[model samples]
Target: MSAHVLIPTTSNLPAPRPAPDRSGTPTPGRPNRERGSSPHEGERLRPLSRGQVEDRRQELGDLYAEVSGGGPWAWNEARADFLRHLASDARRPGFSLLIAETTVLTGCAYGFPLIGAGPWRADFGGHVREGLLRRVAPGRLFVVSAIVVPPRVRRENQDRAWNLARRLQRRLLADDGAALGVTLVEARNDGIAETLRSWGWRSAGDGTLTAVPPGSCRVLVLTAGT
Candidate 1:
């Protein structure tokens, strides 16, 4: 339902005309037009469902660890171990794992988002920066993870990873409406930054604007909003 109201700003006011519908019929039982309304009334966003909001809270928490001040080299070993754990549990219901050379298969799709944007947090772990975003909201609705092969591995996997990222963003948009965005972080030379620019991400600010070492991983940041 929709209604319009009018208010008088001056000391003296005149009468107002009634509002009409598309058919030109005056709406009956219309709201009082003299009352003043809050200036921010229309700016409030529609409240998301409780479950969806909780999931967003968790994702925000996970994002903190997605960006690490430390270098990726220091964290590769632990990341590998975590991937191994996820792979071991592939047979479980609501769970699967994949190992690929240059691309993330189905099981690794969820984690691809985090790998592109993560500082994943677990109770025992301080901050899990590298890797994919495996577990989703609502307790096992979706989960995924991956192993980033050595540089010797062909870059073909990157294409697969890109595809997975696109799918993930689409899913997130469907669920949360306009409440998400994606960011891409890459080595200054990986051309990842250029790719992000082409995709319509206005460069916000440089990350850790230091002399990035050769082969250092890049960071991509994506977000969605309602």
Candidate 2:
């Protein structure tokens, strides 16, 4: 495991909070909400090194369970699957993890650069033109594997949650200097698919490209500066 690295918070976002207390609790402070300030002003966003991610696996799993919203068995299964993916993804070249928090972990997003032509490309089923792929440079394409934000946050202030999600995605892409970002959303998950579309992601293809059951998911893409 490499030493953890913390990316400096962007100037447009809120400044970092005072150091946490010995108990690891964030100090109480008012959010800076000047005009043009980020809606996520009260939260801090930081990138986690692979080492840091391994250290926080349990905490991340719990957060995933909470966000997934299921009974005990389902939660357990979801957490396990999340852990498995995290382990595999962490080893990929240029893997990056960004987490948001205030008093506790509120959300997380992670991904790795898409390097070379892999089996996953076949999943696109030719929807992603070869010429387009060459133009973007596969190495410059980042795949956002997951974005997990608790439901309560969305329930209380959906706009804030939306901004947070966007911040996480953009930061990840910026960190890698990626030209394009890609993610897949289940076709049945209309809420998330709609959210991604509203955020300027265009659908490139459907699950027929990748799913055992056609139409199970949709592929969405966001080019840099879009």
Top candidate on lDDT is: 2
Residue 152 shift from truth in candidate 1, angstroms? 23
Candidate 1, residue 207: the lDDT equals 38
> Which candidate's TM-score is highest?
2
Q: On residues 1-226, what C-alpha lDDT tens digit does candidate 2 reach at each position?
A: 1111111112111232233232212346844342244454677889998889999999998887666654677668767877877887788788899999999998898988878565555664344556556768658988888777644332233334246666677788988999998876654455565555655577764422333245455667877754
Q: What are the per-residue Cα lDDT tens digits for candidate 1 across 1-226?
A: 0000001111112221232332112257755321333211222122233344344433322221122112454234333434344334333333322222222111112222221222232310221132323323323122223221221111112233233233343344444332333332324433334433333333323433234456443333344421
Clashes of 1: 33
lDDT of 1 at 123: 17
Candidate 1 — which residues are off by over 4 angstroms?
Answer: 1-108, 112-167, 173-211
Angstrom error of the Cα, residue 145, model 2: value is 0.5
TM-score of each: 0.26, 0.70
| Position 219, candidate 1: lDDT | 37
